[model samples]
Target: MIALIGAAVAPGIAILSYFYLRDSLEPEPISMVIRSFIFGMLLVVPIMVLQYIMQNEWNWRDGIVAEVFQSAVVEEFFKWMVIYFTVYKHLEFDEPYDGIVYAVAVSLGFATLENLFYLIINGTNIAIWRAFLPVSSHALFAVWMGYYLGRAKFSKDAKHERLFLWMSITLPIGLHALYNLIFLAVQNWLVVIVPFMLILWWQGLKKVQRAHDFGSKNLSSRPQ
Candidate 1:
């Protein structure tokens, strides 16, 4: 029971840290952030339920194509859509980095629930592995998605704007699919995926820094 609680709660805390860090730069009201987190989790529940059904019906042995399309594709699509339609337009999304912030929130929300389910069924050891790697990977995936979303939000060029928006969805989905494939092919190779996750963390940090710099510049230029 202690292990189960840790497995369920730890990822949510880790993902919440990203928001707390971002809040340091451009502080959102705690109430708003809490609302966003809850909403994000609420929005993804249907997708999770659907995935559960599909997994039982088709199973991974069906083939790579089926697994990718039915599992990874379906899950990522719904998560991304929730961010794009619901969170993207929120007033709190005032800067480019806001994209990354909110995207990570939604992704982590989905991941937290998914992790809890897996941990409950599989047990503690599997939960430990998932807590470190897959949970972090989902956070990284959101980082990139938010990076492109920031670009799309801030870009002046119409073509570039559209490109960034599309890339925001596609790139994360591709990374997510690849991550799933790697785990599917050789579960032992998760150690190798750690470096890729590190790269993603670096990328997310860069985007956040860029957004901070941009906001700083704008503030400095404003007449008092």
Candidate 2:
């Protein structure tokens, strides 16, 4: 049981640590990072409730649209909410990279708790699979959002800021929906999934490096 819990948690923590390290400038307050994480953990309830209603009551669970919306749109939206309310306007959010730092912290929190529940019910037999697929995928999706989020924060122009913010939310939803769709379309076709994850990892790593390289001043690298 201890091992199972550890196995469930390792991926999120490891990824969180990696992102934390990428904060090249001053790090944000640990308390705030932790606060972001706890808030994210708490969001699981509302997200689950919303998804449950959509799946059970609304009967959207029968189609691929449901799979995409419920998994990608719903989860990402709540995570975005957690950020917008909790850390978005906080004074500590002073730099571009801070977005990724806080974003990953909250995301790992969500991923860690989500993983615990899944591993608890399904047992550790699938632990490896969960880590590679769900846990890591959550981190990547957060990166997708965080990259744009970071840009939006330091964006000088109001229109650029709004565009970046919009991309932060929408891009992740699209990537996440694609991730879910790949799994939904073909069971046990990890071959297809592995390449997709690899491509995402390449893109995400660049984002990570960009965040790492961000100077004390905000760089104006808007994505096209």
The most accurate candidate by lDDT is: 2
Worst 10 residues of 2 by lDDT: 215-224
Q: Give a tens-digit lDDT track for model 1, residues 22-111.
A: 745566556665665665677566876676677676564465765577656776677778778876777777667777777777777777
Which candidate ranks first by TM-score, i.e. highest? 2
State, as a TM-score between 0 and 1, how close model 1 is to the true structure: 0.84
How far residue 80's Cα lies from its native spot in candidate 2, in Å, is: 0.7
Clashing pairs in 1: none
Quantify how close model 2 is to the true structure by its C-alpha RMSD in Å: 3.6
How well does candidate 1 score on lDDT at residue 15?
71
In model 1, the Cα lDDT at residue 112 comes to 79
* Candidate 2 lDDT, 1-224, residue by residue in tens: 89988998888888888888777677788888888888778888788898889988988866687868988999898898788778888889877778888888888899899999999999999998998988898888998788888888777799999999999999999999988888788877688999999998999899877866664435345333
